[model samples]
Target: MELRVGTLNLASGRDGGGRSVDAAGLRAALADVDADVLAVQEVDVGQPRSHGVDQPAEVAAALGASDWRFAAAVTGTPDPFRSWTPVDPPVLRASWETLTGPHYGIALVSRLPVRRWSVLPLGAGRAKLPLQAPDPRTGETRWWWFPDEPRLAIAAELEHATVVSTHLSFAPHTALRQLTRLRRWCARLPGPVVLAGDLNLVGPVPARVFGAPRLVSEPSYPAPGPRVQFDHLLGRVAASRPEVRRLTIGDHRLVTVSVHPG
Candidate 1:
């Protein structure tokens, strides 16, 4: 069976007119790539940033997927910003307690038949160390250190193989820790496996550091600019070189991997 995967960073709901408004470019981008299984990051379920649109569901529907699942990395409290960023229309906005604040999360949608689904939420926080590396060619400091919640990976038992998707932490150290943890998780799974998401390592690390064979990495972030591949897709099954494509939808660019198992 062929497995097609995609990853996108849906800008926060704060920018979307507080409702489900078709993001002009985004809608077209999705139509262009037409992935069978999509893993999206920075999707908001209930926030004005995305105009309170259920981004995951909307995208799934747009892509003609029959099933979809979402896992929140950060579940906003009902009044998280009440004491912090209070609004001017306090009394009016207070009437609807549930309609306040944006809830950020990640999601996986698929057209392939799924037998089971599971999620692992990587803790949210900053890296403990400062990673400072200078570009060899430009002699410029590439600040690779930044704190972000631990990545959340999704696992699914597909009809022919197991599929996994995750967004890695920004900090190199955090990503290292996450990679080690991912290896452990992969060891326990049975049968051929397909792993995809923002692995955060752009260049030669996929085969060197991770030690996985038959892997493909593609640039999927900061669309239409200097390409720095932050997204990736890997598989355990031996096969031909997987095809990689970049999809820029809305304001985010997604990477899609098409893999063939041996």
Candidate 2:
């Protein structure tokens, strides 16, 4: 059987143009992906800024995916130097206590049946760097001091394989640590496993660190004109070349790969 999977960074519920994410656009974008499983990053859950909408749930619903999990990295609006508390397990797959407060993190949604679910916390790093992004004053690209946030990875054990997704720290040194830790976790899973997301490590570095072949090698950030392969899908499985898609809503372009199971 062939399984299609993709990674999408919601960019915190908005487009590169800063418009709030909506179901219609989500549906259209997901239609293009037609993925059976999608790993989402920068998701907002029950947040006032996003009108309290459950972003991961909304995306899942849009894709008609019945299986989904959102691992909260922090509660309330995110701050540079640690201003939010981390929620524990049972806090997700998210709907349980989402109404209790707001949350920001990553998610995994699957149209396929999921036999198990898991989460991992990659502690926040103490490095801040100026990264390339749109300049608020000029509406052009410029390097701005970006702060790293607490990162989280979510995984789903489907009948055939286990897949993981996460958004790593922008700080290179810290990202390396998280990747190493995640690799150890993957080693214990089933025969074949795949990992996907905005790893923050560019090019062959992620594949090298992950000890897996990268399925996609397209630049996915700065959606306007991508120039780096920050988004990726890497693993030891048969997969078609990844398709980098431009979604109507999101700062990062969606990257999809078709997996052919043996």
Please tell me which predicted candidate would have the highest lDDT against the true structure: 2
CA lDDT, candidate 2, residue 211: 96
How do the residues 68-90 of candidate 2 rate in per-residue lDDT, one tens digit apiece? 88888877654331355666543
Clashing residue pairs in candidate 2 are: none
lDDT of 1 at 260: 63
Report the lDDT tens digits of candidate 1 across residue range 1-262.
6667666665442122212244443455466656778777766665543445556666776687766676666545232222222121211111012333445556778887678777765554454435443322232345543336435777767777777777777677777678777767866765476666776666657545555653555455555562666666666665443454434333335556666654
Which predicted model would earn the best TM-score?
A: 2
Worst 10 residues of 2 by lDDT: 133-142
Q: In candidate 2, residue 255 scores what lDDT?
A: 92
TM-score of 1: 0.73
lDDT comparing candidate 1 with the true structure: 0.57
In candidate 1, which residue ranges exceed 4 Å CA deviation? 13-28, 77-101, 128-147, 238-252
**What are the lDDT scores of the predictions, listed in order?**
0.57, 0.78
**Candidate 2, TM-score vs. the true structure?**
0.88
Worst ten in a row by lDDT for model 1: 87-96
Return the clash pairs for model 1, or none. Answer: 13-48, 13-49, 13-50, 14-49, 18-51, 19-51, 26-249, 26-250, 123-150, 124-149
The C-alpha stretches of model 2 lying farther than 4 A from their native spots are: 23-25, 78-82, 88-90, 94-97, 129-146
